[model samples]
Target: DFFIEFSRQGPCILSRSILQLLYLPLFNKVFGTLNFADVLKDAAKNFIFPPVLMPKSTLLLNPQAKEYVDTFLTHCVRPFGNLVQLCGHNRARQRDKLAHLLEDFATLQDEGEWKTIEEKPPPSSPGRDSNLDLPVLSSLAQHDKRVSQLRHGGGGLDVDSYHRTGEAQCQRAERVDAYLHNLSLKSDSPRPHLACFGTWILYHTLRVMIMYLLSGFELELYSNHEYHYIFWYLYEFLYGWLVSALSRADSFLTEQEAMAEIHKGRGTKKNKSKKKKTRPYGREITIYQALQNICGGFYKVHIM
Candidate 1:
């Protein structure tokens, strides 16, 4: 809110406005795009503290400019730094917690593959009890545990945790979609532009996935044989999803632009020519595509 108020004061506060310049790069760093101008429009169009644009010449410099800068750093920059540290801690915690479930899941898959290839049932563990009934009872209890975990949204195997996380993610996305729809209907705001905020959320989710994958390399975590599936996970999951999200957002923005032109009565040949020159999110989408290609290439090389 302080930044919003400061931004409305004037573009020039002796020099370039500190908050405006900071917001551009900070938003870009967080969202992976510099197309946050649409969000700025929400303040104006929604009448939520609409910026009263003052001419630079008449603007009086704030006497507490130094204090504002220090406050901004304390409030904004410090929290961001804390967020980065929290992410790192979460990554380490996930690795520690999920490592065993991942190994167990992989072992189960390998056993299934062996059973198929050999045309026989899988062998029991080498250190198993001689009593067959104990094994069966143990398996049944384990199965019950897994079922209970699934029902209660508790952690079981790595795969079950993933499923629950995915479900929660979907639910959150649905809530956001509903919120944006309601917002547009109530306020008569541009929905697609506001929906860019949803895309920004997707971008942060994608970034977290990327960080999780990269941390594997930084810690020399995966083994030589595991590298194949690790790269496969990166290719199939993270980058591919990123490209899809970015493409969808870009299309939404383009449609929003087109509809806006139509509303403004700019459907002339000259306007069309100008529109042809503009490419919404062109650079960001291109970068995502390139990363997807690189991940695909790495995956192919690993598999081969």
Candidate 2:
């Protein structure tokens, strides 16, 4: 609301206004990409005492001249900052508290601080009756591992232009593959390995997305111009997303490659005798096999 109000008054006015607003929040508070907190503080201040815009010459002559002017029509860009106000302050406050707790939890996990707790050692004496039921235990363990890593290895995008070169993308792909290798080992179920390479027709979608992000990253932007929204914010997001995806692909492919050798016949099923064919259908091949076939055929992109 605050930013949009500035927009209606034209470029020079909006730029000067925000530049001045940025100068006001001098280290007493931290600002974010959205700067929601600062914007809200500014709005409440304006509501109590609205802001007025003055011409450059007028401001030089009397800096306080606009302060005396009625602010009835000078509330430029005051409403856009209410982006998430539908949720009352009470709910927002609770969310903030919960967020802090989650941050602490994540920090602990990242640092493996939980391992610091001393656990009571198991008795060395053998039990009168001992049973080793491994199948069920192993299955459960696998399920828990997969569930935990469901959202793992993903991170915020790398927006540093220095990180966007072709060589960098390749390196990112390698790191992603390394992480995936670890994920696959935890599973080693033979299912994910197959699934990752087995799907067909995904490249059609992935190629388009990759190109869109690539183009957005290359687009030129003008300072204080209209391109900031598209170029800086959206493009940065897409680039990050692209980097994340490349890593995932690298991991999946790496696992698929290892599994390809293990399950020499990745996976396949024959059609009925009447419709029997020497070659396997797309669905019949393992995921890795499908990916290999598709990439080679469409883009001639080979996956090692």
Candidate 3:
């Protein structure tokens, strides 16, 4: 309000008016009315007097000038300095207080200071059994046990001791046979030793025997080509055999039927009049004729 009033009148007019008001004894006397009575009623109450001394001091400091810089600085600049210092402090509590103070001062300018008070009780911790009450360890142990059980239970069938022993011996024999066979095959010439020749012949003979067993002896008899020749040969041989057997059985049945028909005298054929067969013209001639007919029709239409 003071600043607004100050701004309404030009600064020069405002300053001259304030200078004239400061020197006027009448203005001081008017303010002194309440103070004069307060002094009579109770001398202590006179201490709460209006701020008329500020302007009076400005007049004494500069009698020739209309305004003094110190009065303006004291009224405006000092509070701003206090605000800056309050804001600059490193303490959090002081900084927060200063911010609230600034907000109050900005809103309530020359009015009294705004005060805030808060009463909060100190914080206290919960009891000591909190960590032990957590279920993390128990849950982890259960998870681990479940994982271990799955690992053990998911392993495939376990062979018995006797079966494992027999399998091991068979595998060893197979490996030795393979090694000896490879060695014999790698030899430049046939050997005279009966055991060597016997082994060589046995290996190949066993291979052929196994091939026959696997292919049912059919592929060996029929096929000469080597690429899946065994499988196709075996398939063809089996199919042919089956068909031959079925045909033989069917022929026997047919013979029986024929004999029955003959015995019943129902097998004779009757002669019918014959008709000569006409050969059909080839598609090329038919197509050419169709094309000619289409062309002639098209030409006639075009001429019309």
For lDDT, the strongest prediction is 1
- Tens-place lDDT digits, model 1, residues 13-92: 43333433454445424243533333433422232111111123111133343232223223232323323323223345
lDDT for residue 35 in candidate 3, whole number 0-100: 29
* Candidate 2 local lDDT, 1-304, one digit each (tens): 3332443244464454454456333322224344444453353322221111111222213333323122211221221222122112232242333323332222212211111112232222111121211121111112222221111133112222212232222332233223332344554241232112111111212222333322333432122222222232222332333333333444444444444445564466533454332322223234434443443343221111
Q: Would you list the clashing residue pairs of candidate 1?
A: none
Clashes of each: 0, 14, 0
Consecutive 10-residue window with the lowest summed lDDT within model 3: 110-119
| C-alpha positional error of residue 79 in candidate 2 after TM-score superposition, expressed in Å | 39
Ten contiguous residues minimizing lDDT sum, candidate 2: 195-204
Return the lDDT, model 2, position 137.
14
Model 1 has an lDDT value of: 0.39
Per-model TM against the reference: 0.47, 0.20, 0.14
Candidate 1 residue spans exceeding 4 A from truth: 1-81, 84-165, 186-196, 266-275
How do the residues 161-255 of candidate 3 rate in per-residue lDDT, one tens digit apiece?
Answer: 21233233333223322333344344442111112211221222222222222332232322222212223222322222222322332333344
